[model samples]
Target: MKKFFSISFVLLLALSGILAGCGSDEAGGEAGKKIKIVAAHNQTSPDNPYQTGLLEFKEVAESKSNGDIEVEVHAGTIGTEESELVEKLKLGAADVVLVSPGFMTQTGIKEIDLLAMPYLFDNYEHWEKTVDGEVGEEMAKLINEKSNNDFKLIGYWSAGVRHYYGKKPLEKMEDMKGLTFRTQTSGVVADYWKKVGAIPTSIAWGELYQALQQNVVDSSENSYPYFVQQNHHKTDNGKYITETAHDYTTRFLLVNGKKFDSYSKEQQDIIIEAAEASVKAEREAVYAQEDEYKEKAIDDGAKVNEIDREPFIKLAEPLQEKAAKDMGAEDLLEKIRNLK
Candidate 1:
């Protein structure tokens, strides 16, 4: 009887060890589960600054996660429109996205339109000060709250300073009259353009090259790197570039806030760090490419000219002030101007 009892006791100990091994494996698997992130931007060009910025994000995120995180970046693959990206982001289809203020405003976040106002920023210095300071923090908090945690602003990115490029150069304020300009169709930007006498027309970014080639639009405005890289200068309606310096454009690097909240504290810290790195890399790329592409445009026979921007700035200021008040952003507007 004693011998039988000893054998049963040994079996019981072995069973307990087996169960403990299974528990350890289950916990290990849960802790080491691989996470996948889908990062996307609207620009398709591999040489574009958007690509540069996102690539930096991917590198930083993956490296910091030690192979537990995988980032799949889609540059106009999943969607070419900012609206589409924003929609996907809200639905949790996209993990991270890049979008401009105008498109973001269409998602019912009109307060963001303040960033899209023409002549709102005088230069890159003013822009950096506004977006990297307390004003930016307030805007970010507003976005998070307004979005109900659907969107979280990771960083502010620049599309560089926008200038006017079209079939004809604007020598003066009157030169814009009657021009069918391809630009934002709504918000303060379109209002400012119309007030300056250019009839604003909506054109998709990918379609603008064809529109310019076919004379569907008489004029368009953008930064040098954007239009020049698309070979817009080669189009019949895109040869003349006037340095209006109208908008120092702002883009938002956003993550799905709910998904972000679901991540471990370590993962969230890594993502924020990655976003900071991306912001720096992207701005540097845009600054460098602006000079590079401007030279390229000139060398490629695009006529470049400078106009008296004071008139445009004068036309834009009242609109900016009124729009700021309408959106309850009067203080934010004052803050922006003070930064200048």
Candidate 2:
């Protein structure tokens, strides 16, 4: 009887130990699992610049982390409107996003608008130096501070130079007078157009095509690739492509601060490195497509003109000064101008 009781007690002890071991293993497994990060963008799959960056980030991050992190791109899957994406990031519904500077400026971080100021950058080299240098660092710091650490601007990706596309050829600023042009609903852009005597009509991008087709808006401005890819030239009958180069726009990739903070140091470093690589790849893709798209536009019977930029610059300088004052971004603008 004594031996039987002893054996039973030992059996119960062993079972309890086994159960505890299993529970611990399950907990550790759950803790050790790879993190899944979702990145959202305004462009649809396989068609947006965000697509290339998304792939690059995923490839680099997964490889560097050895499958400890997974990045899934929710391209155009989150929201089409830039403002909506920004709001989603703030609410923690989205982990990361790729959005335009114009949209970011509207969030009360107006210093970013300096990037959209007309002709602030002479070429890609100038733009890159400013973005990757001290000026960019300062701007990033300000953005993070302004957002109360809800959003962090990780890096910038270029959208190329913007130009005017109209139904009739515009040879000078005077020709743009009283012309109804579709503009982003940004005071900075609208005010700039107003200064040049163009009627700035606000329109959402998704509705722009139909609006142009039905003659609701007579003209618009965007990069060559955007103009071609969006088929803006097709709907705007008698398309006139002018080389106004009004703004060198850039898109920002933002990360939710809390989500970013949740990552380990190693994981954070991996994300940053991946973003840098993706930015480089994206810039190369953009440069290659710029001329290719311009050629396509010409082939499609769109008249392309290489206009004299001096006249446009003269008209824009005073407006630039005014914008800098209104947005309180003059110091950053000066720093950008000094970048090599």
Candidate 3:
């Protein structure tokens, strides 16, 4: 009876070892098994720059892996809400996503909001220097650390520089006084406009056209590509576009860091390559679209004016400093300012 029991225990141990090996084989570097990723962003437009970047990622990953890895790009089909995507990433339902700093703050990483401060970058050149350099690397590290490795910043992209468009063009700082300006929901953006004497109002991006048509908000700020694509210029309250150039925006391409770490080393390297390619493609798309849409807006009769940006920059300094201190990113802010 003792000999029979020993034989049965040996068989069970052998079987468990085989099963564990099978599990690893099925997950990585195995025949007939592939890693699939769901990549998503909240831009609904088929031609949006986010789509351009994500599609490139899918293309590169699939081509490099020779069918070992497949990426599915969901352009707002998965979720139009950045918040929803962030939640899905945490739940392991989504693999990759794009998000702005404001929405990122909702994840409890308020230090990221410093990127959204007014006059953060002097121009696209200064903007590129900051975000493509050491400052960007540190910010990416903070995101991953704060999220407990739930979020990994793969690459940085741009949404073009933001400008002010409203009922009338501003020739001086005093023009902003008393105007109801449509801006971000909160954070340093709203505060900056408020300091300039404009009453900052929050309006949903999709609902903004009607709000402007009905005078719910007298003015709004955005890049030419965004506002022109939505025809914000056609509205009576949006005809005059002033080049305030307050923000040179940054968007992050993030992946589920834990999921990323779970990937095989070869697969992880392939994904990093794909992300680098996508970043280049996305930035090129945004820069081209900025000029293309600006011309379109001008042809569509949206009056464009250049404001003296010096006073506005001066107004933004104290506000930027306060916001940086509040977010505990004062050093990061100083690095960015010095980058310009």
Among all candidates shown, the one with the greatest lDDT: 1
Please provide, for model 1 over 1-340, each residue's C-alpha lDDT reduced to its tens digit, 9 standing for 90 to 100.
Answer: 0000111222233223322333342332244456789999988889899999999999999998897778999989989889999999999999999999999888778888999999998788888877777777777877877887789888888898999888988899899999999999988889999999999998888898999999999989988888898999988799999999999999999998777766655566577778888888888899999999999999999999998999898888999999999999999999889987
lDDT (CA) per prediction: 0.84, 0.75, 0.82
Candidates 1 and 3 compared by lDDT, better number: 1
User: Top model by TM-score, which number?
Assistant: 1
Per-candidate TM vs. native?
0.90, 0.87, 0.87
* Regions more than 4 Å wrong, model 1: 1-32
Q: Which sections of candidate 2 miss by over 4 Å?
A: 1-33
Model 2 over residues 1-340: C-alpha lDDT tens digits? Answer: 0010111222223223322333342332343357888888876537555677778888998999899989888877778788999999999888778888788877888878878778788777777777766666676777777887788777778887889998887887788898898886456777778877889887777777788888999899988877688778887632898888888777887888666666665666677778777777777667777888889888887898877888878877777778888778888777777764
* List of clashing residue pairs for candidate 1: none
Instruction: Extract clashing residue pairs from model 2.
Output: none
Give candidate 3's error at residue 223 in angstroms. 1.0
In model 1, state the lDDT of residue 315. Answer: 88
